[model samples]
Target chain A: MNDDALPPARAIEFWFDFGSNYSYLSMMRIEALATARNVRIVWRPFLLGPVFRQLGFENSPFVLQKEKGAYVWKDMERQCRKYGVALTRPSTFPRAALLALRVALYGANEPWIGAYCRKIMQLNFADDREIGLPEVVSEALGSLDLPAQHIIETAQSDANKLHLREQTEAAIRRGIFGAPTFFVGDEMFWGNDRLDDALDYCEAMSRRDR
Target chain B: MNDDALPPARAIEFWFDFGSNYSYLSMMRIEALATARNVRIVWRPFLLGPVFRQLGFENSPFVLQKEKGAYVWKDMERQCRKYGVALTRPSTFPRAALLALRVALYGANEPWIGAYCRKIMQLNFADDREIGLPEVVSEALGSLDLPAQHIIETAQSDANKLHLREQTEAAIRRGIFGAPTFFVGDEMFWGNDRLDDALDYCEAMSRRDR
Candidate 1:
């Protein structure tokens, strides 16, 4: 069907935290999959650190659950290989996502937001870069051919920080406890593997509307 | 290919605890898939309760992470609908699998082991019965045309008690952290969704041997 024949586009809300390996998988793969299925993507960036705290976790649940943590690392390696993406294990688990997330939401309206999200994840999961620093995020913006200083400044503002906090609170309200959660309308799909299911939900809606 | 032309049969070890929701999902579906793919199924019953305690968990991880816990219940419903299984959510989460497992392992040599397993899971997950009770398990065994008294008595015997303990230890030694963990020639796959991947691994080995 042509654009006019298509249903009113229902964009999938992708809720992701910067520190998640599976979120990296979803970020790298969601765009192409969503584009092919003609589902628009709404990239919602937030920190999982605060969310984890609510679960009484001192750190990543993976860190506490050692054997599953071992499997997670292996799963990431297998996934990176399958997706043909280079990944060097980050020496640190969950570098504070506060800075990256603030800037990501700040740029949420910019046309390059998706590109920006992909680059941030690649630098974290692939290059093992310290994305917690302002410099790394500045470098990420520069590479995207977007202005670095202004976006960085706005992201650093107190209002934007509060905005990011609100985004996180909203996520908690949505009953999201993990990163890379997706929404097709009010229906929730969690984890990177559920990406297709989210898209299928969108496609099913389109068919129903038609 | 005919049976004579095929390689020696390869069995996939299905390691599960009766209390696990995903294990119930796997138990409900594994046999048909394995049969169709010409792969043998090795039913290995063990307790995740002991395993979780070793990880410092007082209860199911699903219960600890309430939001994710909520998602898990919904996911179970979706999985059941998809698989054509009747799932009346158990009144209690993570019922003690000790009694059921010991009895299950005692029947490991019997021809009706798989059917017995499927029925026990249905009683736990579909009928909302308290599987921790010996009476419930006896009822399940009676329905299966098996001798309940002999099996339960043998399972409660000191030899069978030691056998079940050893199985749980072996699961830990094998690096299994969760229920419904599948092993196709020592390559481990976790969760019910991975059932297909495990079967594929066995089928590929069959092709390679041929």
Candidate 2:
């Protein structure tokens, strides 16, 4: 088969947390990048809290490692400036991401996933707001013209919670120990900045298969 | 006592590998950050190749994890564009950094230390040349009007080799598993980007001591 006749690259899976500053940068850019590369993106939000706990981390890796923490803030600033995104250090980090993740899981099939993610990240980092606060989240949902009551109610359901838990376990099984992970085929790329390279690899694989 | 009259913050030791792309970014920027925050930066050059081998990694953590590798390359590109640093992926990675690191160690006490590091990184990443090449290194030294022979001879000396080894051992003992690690007082920060926060912590400490 001619390479030119091959199917285009498969969609990318982006797993992220609301508390991750780098996730904000990736989410903000993933659309444009996907469009440019002609690849689809699946937004997957998961609570990093459980992941960190399971990995024996009491806090963000940055906080546990001083230099890493310092760089994370500065790097976040740099990325935000470059992307024309507003970012401020959140007052509380590692905020309860459960509700947000649940909302995302239920909305996974919806077209509003990308916009909701961008808004939540901005609410946490750009506005320095507590994502765990119901008011703050409700405000974000209201802005999106989303049914805040329905989404929140569905997100808190036992079924969705179990699904989110199972997904986290799956991520761990796949060797993921961090937030902002991406997957192309069976390859797992951790961190937000890797989106483009993930897309490239997928494209390459598709071409090769053809 | 006035805050302005306080002693400088305790120095931070930065362990880096010249061959590390992220380390290059930190090395180039840490000095300015240190100066601004009234903190001293002690540059430590060690061999990561040996460390990786010991850890059973054949290459960078990114490469060992496919998803991470993709993100790192793309993220690096974005960072380079943001920092106005010219960069292209090196054709060969994990270049023999021993010679370059030795030279860096030899020049640690000299004023040319920063300039030497910047030039070497530029040559390797920006210019896409073999930094391990003796001629390339000599040219870099020549440009600085330094005695390339003397530096090279010193770097290859038994004493320097022992020092490098000792430093690597010290890093391992300190829980360092990667390049661009920094230690400020008892706090450890890993990765080049954390330099700013390291400096900030130093400044805050200085203020508190007053």
Candidate 3:
């Protein structure tokens, strides 16, 4: 398959949870990656807490698996270095993500979703700040020239909660068990590092159709 | 720190699950890696089923995430090709691992634990066969001129199960949630690909001590 032959690359739907460190990496890079590959990105923010609960997990997999957890922290450093992205471990993980998720969901339809999402991720991962706090969230929105009250108000609405729930269930149906998952047609790629491979697959599939 | 100034490398305890695909890759390459780096390797095999159960994962993460599952199969192909290893999807996944895990636990006292572990991994991953079946497990053992029954008997003993359980608990206590996990002193590297970086860490630590 050639890169130009398949249907124009479908919007790459990114289902992420704010508390996920790897998701932070993917959120930071998705825009540049999409532009380079001529693909579109759709941000879908959901609660990993719910997913983990359903899967019987009390915390992040890194905390559950000693060796894997240790590796991930170091591996994150390596990846950040490779990508030339600055990274500092978040002070408190599994942070209360309700507000951040609500904000992202509220901004889901805005033209500035990409910028807003990146900022939130950077606030937590790169800046080592608490993203769950209302004030921290408000400040991030204020810097974007977005009205914090409007975003928070929309996020707190029953409509938005239902919307978020539906998306989470949809992700479950789509076979997603973690944050930072991507799909192209029937193919799924998990983790931030797999972003390039996912894009390559789309490019290859497009070529094949041509 | 300079690489040569490091202290002598401490033995690496390799914790593996028989059914893990990545573990298969690591088991195959560990010897060559250990030799080149002059580090001792201690083979530790434990049951992933129990670990998963404890972590509340009913199946592989790939299976849980549809998009991820799709991407993983293809990615596995790409990675296998890169490593020049055969990549065939095993017919039976989460294969019955009782016998295979037992063999590993039984061989813990032997000098050939590393070599024997590698052979089983190749047989399961490279040959795309079921490692749980006695015939398949025995054939792999016979090729090494080891008595299959003796290994099986040892693996089935209460002592081995106790040992395996202890190791699993230790891993959990250490915050390990996945296979192919490596530890150098207190530094942890989680995946097979991270072997080089883990070795780099070991080299650095050894130098610092000197």
| Chain A TM-score, each candidate | 0.93, 0.90, 0.90
Off by over 4 Å in 2: A1-9, B1-15, B18-100, B107-153, B156-210
Reference interface contacts recovered per candidate: 0.67, 0.00, 0.60
- Candidate 3, CAPRI quality class derived from DockQ: acceptable
Segments of candidate 3 deviating more than 4 angstroms: A1-7, A53-92, A106-111, A126-130, A146-162, B1-11, B32-40, B47-84, B87-115, B126-130, B133-135, B144-175, B206-210
lDDT of candidate 1 over B94-116, digit per residue (tens): 88868889998888768888898
State the lDDT of candidate 2 residue by residue for B1-210, as single tens digits: 111122335677778887798987787677777776667767778888777766556787666655456657766785687567788788877567678888887777688888888899888888888999888888899899999998898888998877878777766666666888877666666676566666766676767878
Interface DockQ of candidate 3: 0.36
Evaluation by lDDT, superior candidate among 2 and 3: 3
1 or 2, which is superior by TM-score?
A: 1
Question: Which docking class does model 1 fall in?
Answer: medium
For model 1 chain A, give the 10-residue run with minimal summed lDDT: A1-10
**RMSD to native, candidate 3:** 6.2
Clashing pairs in 2: A67-B189, A71-B193, A71-B194, A188-B67, A189-B67, A189-B68, A194-B71
Q: lDDT of candidate 1? A: 0.84
State model 3's lDDT: 0.76
TM-score for candidate 3: 0.73
Q: Where does the lowest 10-residue lDDT sum fall in candidate 2 chain A?
A: A1-10
